[model samples]
Target: MTRSMCRTRRAGKSAGVVAAALMALAACSSSSDSSSHRATGSAPELSGTVTVFAAASLKESFTALGREFQRQHPGTKVTFSFNGSDSLAAGINAGAPADVFAAASPKTMAVVTDKKSTAGTPATFVRNQLEIATVPGNPHKLSALKDLTASGLKVVLCDRTVPCGAAAEKALAAGKVRLTPVSYEQDVKGALAKVELKEADAALVYKTDVRSAHGKVEGVEFPESARAVNDYPIALLKNAPNAAAAKAFIALVRSAEGQKVLTGAGFLKP
Candidate 1:
């Protein structure tokens, strides 16, 4: 009887151990399945066209970046709508189908945020300072902010809605100089274009913009420019149909590769 009982007890112990092992194995299997499901469910594959609404000042650099992005992502076209920051913000607020927005100023970006048009918080990607872009050789001999007020110089400035115009206003306010422009251009490019086309003797534009213009014009540095530095902010649109692509593009813009290209085109990293 004792021997029979001992065998029975040992068998029972073995069964319990086996049962525990089976339970543990089942738990591990359940955990692994959940983990796999989560891993598979988290991130979707990214593709498609990314529509970017950018400030006019970003035209040159962003165009180059768009080309490079297309090279990296075959069949992925980047459609850009370049204009004044306010205009872009207004467009986004009006239900435009833009995937991303890159503005020349935080203040302008506020318009989007206020309207809840942004998918995420805006990130400052670059900083730009104003320079006096003038006709070749600066025939007016313009050198300072006050020089525009001199007799017989045709000056152009960005519209009050744009970042460059805001900077120009702040710079003028800081320097206590009043300048009446021949035209209040609708955008920064328009302001610079006036000088480039010889329609205006000079225009206030970002140094980066002037640099990108190459031989089209010459730039003059002024003291008050330091007081009004414009920060470039970029954000994904709230209604972005291609949110993943928009995020990827924003990452690329903030990445070292993007910075290299932007800096090369005269943008300063923020």
Candidate 2:
């Protein structure tokens, strides 16, 4: 073969080799980038149920949040036990199968934390102030904490052990008003229910509870509520059966979307 032809053939082979190497490198880089993307974008899959014990006043907001959490994690379910914060704390201390505990006050959360029943420090997520829930239309014109003490008014209150009841007591004291309810309910919902059912003329309950009532009762705000706002704390239980999901749920509760829902339901920001 001629030297010129030989050189041209060698050059062609060299160019082919270079092109192959470049293609191979490009493939490798693409594969590496794809792997990195998967590593960074993919998260561990979470499943199973996360049981939450929360104060009754959180019923509306929390239920909405729970539904959102389940929607975000298709395989997970959020079950809630809504009651008085004190009662829920007692249940946790008694070994209730709970994954999370959301109390209306730090004092009630302490009932569990004091026993080391939580995985980490509890975080305050929201605050709630007191309101007088009167029968719809303010029939008796009950406007303030003192108004609840009027003679012959059937007033209802949450039991003093619960956060709502405790806050009510503080508000009453702050107003320097004395009140004796016809009955003391176990949770804020129960107290609100008394007014809704017309079983009581008025009930001292959380503003959130009154808002959730949706015109079933009329809410009367008093200045004393500022002094008695209750801080709500949430924690993952130490023995949570579904810790992964529980932690995610807690994260959702503190997220901006969660705060929007809570604030819309009349809960105060923490």
Scored by CA lDDT, what does every candidate get?
A: 0.81, 0.81
Report lDDT (Cα) of residue 185, candidate 2. Answer: 94
The TM-score that candidate 1 achieves is: 0.82
Lowest summed lDDT across 10 adjacent residues in model 2 is found at: 6-15
C-alpha positional error of residue 251 in candidate 2 after TM-score superposition, expressed in Å: 0.4
**How many residue pairs collide in each prediction?**
0, 0
State the lDDT at 228 in candidate 2: 93
Per-residue lDDT of model 1, residues 1-270, tens digit only: 233331211122322432333333233334455456557986444568999999998887788778666655555889999999999888888888889999999999999987653557899999999999999888888889999899888999998878999999999999999978988998988888898899989999998778767668999999999999999999988889988788878987897656655666667779
RMSD, every candidate, angstroms: 19.5, 18.2
| Candidate 2 residue-wise lDDT, 91-115, digit = tens | 8888889999999999999989988
Error of 2 at 245 (Å): 0.7
